[model samples]
Target: MMLPETLREIIIKSGFIKQEDFDGAVKSARELGKNLTDILIYRGLISEDVLGQLVAEYYKVPYISLSKKVITVDLLRLIPEEAATTFRILPFSKTEDTVSLAMENPLDLEAREFVKRKTGMKIDIYYVTAPDFTAALGQYKKNIQDAFTKIIEENVEKSIGKSGDAVTLGADIPVIKILDTILEYAVAERASDIHFEIMEDSYLIRFRIDGVLRDILSLPIAIHPAIVARIKILSLLKIDEHRIPQDGRFKFKIKENYIALRVSILPGFYGENIVLRILPESTRPLALEELGLIGHNLNFVKQNIRKPHGMILVTGPTGSGKTTTLYSILNILNTTEVKICTVEDPVEYGIKRVNQIQINPAAGLTFAAGLRSLLRHDPDIIMVGEIRDKETAEMAIHSSLTGHLVLSTLHTNDAASTIPRFLDMGAEGFLVASTINLVIAQRLVRKLCTSCIETYKPSEEQLSYLKNFLEDSELTHNFYRGKGCAECGNKGYKGRVGIYEVLEINESMRDLIIKRVSAEDIYKEAVAHGMIPLLRDGMDKALGGITTIEEVLRVVRE
Candidate 1:
């Protein structure tokens, strides 16, 4: 028997579907003039992704996931609409002689014959899940770009030279659906920020993934103001103001998954530049080990954070994942016995059983005021979102001095500058010395996607830089670079990990702090005390094949 027949027999015997179900499917197929596989699937007798997997394994063909894959109109045109509808197949990709089809039932022999005979080409089958197959089919039948592009073109007169059109056009394109597609696709692609910028000649849609911004699509400039208006309406920002920057937020859901996003709009030279930041909601924090803090750096954090009373500060520039590090440690430390309260400028994540408070400057709840109030709650540990000013810095340290473990973040370059920053904020040197326990400085670097990372020999200039950063005498370690692949959206990077420097305070460092030592001298002492710098961590990752040398230098060298 052929593999399809054998597979059908095996599936019938395997008990996912009964003999009666198969019989019903066959009877319905004869009466309804539909394929038996389509009948079974349409009657919800089997799962498409599962069936696709089985067929792929049996026939030794490739399986395709349409979730993150992009489909082009040109590819879809290869298969006629009638043939696709009848066979429940989608044209995924095409070559000169071989055409790849993502099918609801890859084992359908009759459908395969029709494709081969009709197109006069070799046929390749890929299994697609039921929902994905339906969505892909609908997508291929028409162009999605026309939906929004027409809306903008129609309302160009009202949209141009205005922040928002007084009259919103809800025709042809459902504003909600267009926005949903953008947000859903971004989440699926693992984008950190969704950027919409108005250029001189066009409207640009880009996604910032793995710390790099990538072009997604572009539209004519006439459509930008309307799109911006729709976003502002969704985010509840004042759409009429085109001159001033605005910050607003909204929650969006696709199916059962709901995500909270922060919206920031800045007035641009041509128009408005919008950024959407997805907040951590219903997502668990990564474990301490998963934060990429290795060796002594990891040990230093584990040791110092457990101290009953002192301050631990994580310092880095904006968007450096500082808040994420604090939340991860907070999750690890969360206990039924310990009471924890946080004062964040914008609370990003929620921990169960932890008392979290957000600082709203408009509500008389600044970071300092919030911390002062949080102390009265009698919590063992308190977290301040950021130490932006001297008052907040003084308060964070004083809270630590009163025998409370305080955790916070700051905007600084490295561990040595953490104290200098505090002192610059008008914090007393002795108070900073007594309360400070550990300072961690970090940067986020994109991790090379394992699916397509390629090994390469370093150049002479690359080797010279590595020798200065790394202590390796031979530099025999193999280096890897991302070659870009479909899985990673051709970006070569799939995710991000932190490169960190951990500075643990000792009695000698306390003296340096009290003496108001310069940042350079403080850094020398930290290096003497065996603190690993961010550059070293990046170099370690480089040698270990976790990232590339060029990527390491991208953030650290600068």
Candidate 2:
């Protein structure tokens, strides 16, 4: 019962990091009483997948990535839930006499022996990353739909017998439990938003997961008022006022982490329809690589963010991942030598050593006003959440011109149109041309579920549509799509990735901008200068099997 080489030794042998850094992580791991690998991953030193592979190489076992792996319920049932949870092991494949298991620790003989004895078969071991292992373990949890049904059936009777207004039942035990179930499950499912729709006979509960809306439950109309009231009460909104729209937010705790949920209540014919947007707890901003920027686009962002003074504008519609890109850039620029300041409508994340201001129009602290004040702070970098008007747009341009790096977002369809959008906002052509450095437009498309992604030849019509955008149709020989699986909730897609077009303002393009050319003309020049169009970028992803053609078309067309 001997383990393979120590993880620290393997990490050093693999040249993953300097020996001094590994030793420091090992010391912190010992102090925190946590796994060495966990500490490294948490601190953003190494990725889980790469570390898993490194361990598997030393342990002489196969490595598995479970992001898209689909394991059947029957196969999962072979390992008891408690044992699987305790050991971080899952059965992914099985044969007549052999069972293949993916484990976070391939050296855990206890886990291997337990699985072998339970199934009465030879066990084959495979290594899996911590994130993949945790996600796969969710397969053992009870079905969400079943849990929802059970909670409602048990509490419907209590609400059925008594009736007053929403506020009265807001405090009722039955109503509270029902509402709690929805919120709890929504958070558990990684839902971005929850929609409560009032209908003629029933109230519909829907959860928006991975950019798609799904109906979760339907309750009688009698339950609607109480549920709305409960949410309103929790969010500290005016529960009694039903005529006007109301907005508020509240923090919901799950274990040690707190989730901030924004609530919007609107008047409707049947009743008040409510929508709750679940905001994730501020954590580490993803690296640019993880956000789907690669090759030239990645290099463009990297080179420009280091410049001392210029404007970098990320253009996209709402929910298109504009803010995330801004945050990622800020994460790269965050250091002790320079001061960073930001003014946002609502500050999305709290970055250490950065000054962030949330916009309050009511208090006369708008983006324009905030930028003016941030200038006096002698900051090296400034981020404006958005440029919504001429005043804000002009102020941002002015900030960039005066020897300060500026990052901001604007609502535009593509990178080429961003220049014209500035002009439309009444920004001077010379100022826009001189101070602008880069413009990036992006959209999020559902990534094809790795476990169920299927490839096929393109149709003639699809090819024709693509040819209008792609010069070399040979790349379209085979495209991938999700075939729906239990792992992806049968949606064929599991997560989202960004598709971007980066427009680097070179001298030629900058000259055209100062001349006030049309966006179409500017777009042509950008493509000529090696800028990848959004549709082309998405198409490349589709060809690479990162996403489906339909998913790309579905998003880009909008």
Candidate 3:
């Protein structure tokens, strides 16, 4: 059965998907003869857990995530495997008179009745996502690590004494299987990036998990060349040319899901060092509010992006999620009536209906040139990936002044620094003051693991440091932090969230900019005008239990 419109409305009201996307998914579901839930999950418009939660909320049932749940053999024996498989259910826990069962379709009367009769106890039903349910069902079989060990052992023996050229060795079945297993393990561990480092005697493989790198496995240096060659073959790079750096990308699949891997290989002292950035192919741009834009910052971005003509600049150092913020804004403004064009150094993700151009400096199509062409194309909104030079900066400002909403990024420490950065690029004071609407500076901090987050009163020194930014801070206030837990791999952090400072250019700030004031002076003026500083925003989040003070300090300056 299809997802009811009421449940779709619940998801939309919860800010997970837009009305237009939901309607499109509904139409696509009809055309493809698939249910609405499958279409939404397949398209990555909404995650399975979130959709399941919405479904549970609509049905007034409990929702559960089976990711970290451990099901014992005795619990699995509550219901027959055939019945569980046929009904798409799992018996997770059991007591004397009650059994807790997780089901993908809790509304199915047949499944519930079958489960109740089989268990002969009061069944505590929990709604779970399809992926989670399927994964839970796999717990009935062999252990995941055991399966990996078997594959690795068999492959290592197969390649023990085989001698061949790098290309030939790479084409070997054992190397292929080993590489596939490594990739599968990385995906299973939710790695954002994979690093292959060559050493004198060995090759080390590490996965960057939650922004931290940990060694996964090591192999003999003998097979390093074969591994490199295999990666090059997969990414379609030249195997013979290891002296020069090469960049390429390829898609890797695990089950029904596909991951887009961006490959970067550089010649190192030992050998070629490879780094792969893992991006899910089906993922879409997240909503603004979901990007950790809370309260004022959230409201400010919402209001400013809707303006007919102005420039919004997101500033941060490398890997601070500046591109993500830009994509999110573009996602909001993307519509049929308003044509949005972008010129990126390398286009990251393809957004539907937005005209994207990759900047090819070797081909003479720089940001300035592409932007100039876009202006001739008569676009309502423009996105320049970065304003790296005076020419592109001028063009972006010109576009904003010429009745187009422009979004782009700059490499600056904070919101206040963006103004001075523009002036340093030779942008005039009046032009900088007039065309810019808002400046957002952000940094990503690891979020506290919710499953094991604990709260405690801050120390006197910590309280004093936090009070420096917040005036109304109290000494008795308790802040939250994540203790080590299995769910977070004992790191106390699971994911990341952005701490932002949004500076809205007003009359006084514009005047200060036109007068060419120092960045510090502009920062003070913006603070007086209700602009939250990055440290203050981070502290606010820490106080609210979203992250720890230490995590905030790790990224933002005190």
The most accurate candidate by TM-score is 2
lDDT of 3 by residue, 125-169 (tens): 898876567556656543444567788778877876778777898
Candidate 2 per-residue C-alpha lDDT over 1-558 given as tens digits, one digit per residue, 9 for 90 to 100:
122457557777787777787767677666534456765665557777888888788778999887777678788779876688799899999889999999878888888888878999998899987656766766754455567678888997778768777678898999988887888789867788999999998889999988889998888887787888888889888888999999888888765678888888999999899999888775579999889998899999999999999999999989998998999999899999999999997876678999999989989999999999999999999999999999999999899989999999999999999999999999999999999999999999998765455556677887787687666746445566776765577788888899999999999998999999999999999999999999989988876667887789889998
lDDT for model 3 comes to: 0.84
lDDT of 1 by residue, 191-297 (tens): 88999989888888898888888897776676666677778887888878889999888888755667899999999999899999987476789877777887899
List CA RMSD, all candidates: 13.3, 9.8, 10.6
- lDDT to native, each model: 0.78, 0.85, 0.84
Model 2: lDDT of residue 346: 84
- Model 2 ranges with Cα > 4 A deviation: 1-88, 91-138, 164-167, 459-466, 469-476
Off-target runs (Cα >4 Å) in candidate 3 are 1-90, 93-146, 458-472
Best prediction by lDDT: 2
Q: What is the lDDT of candidate 2?
A: 0.85
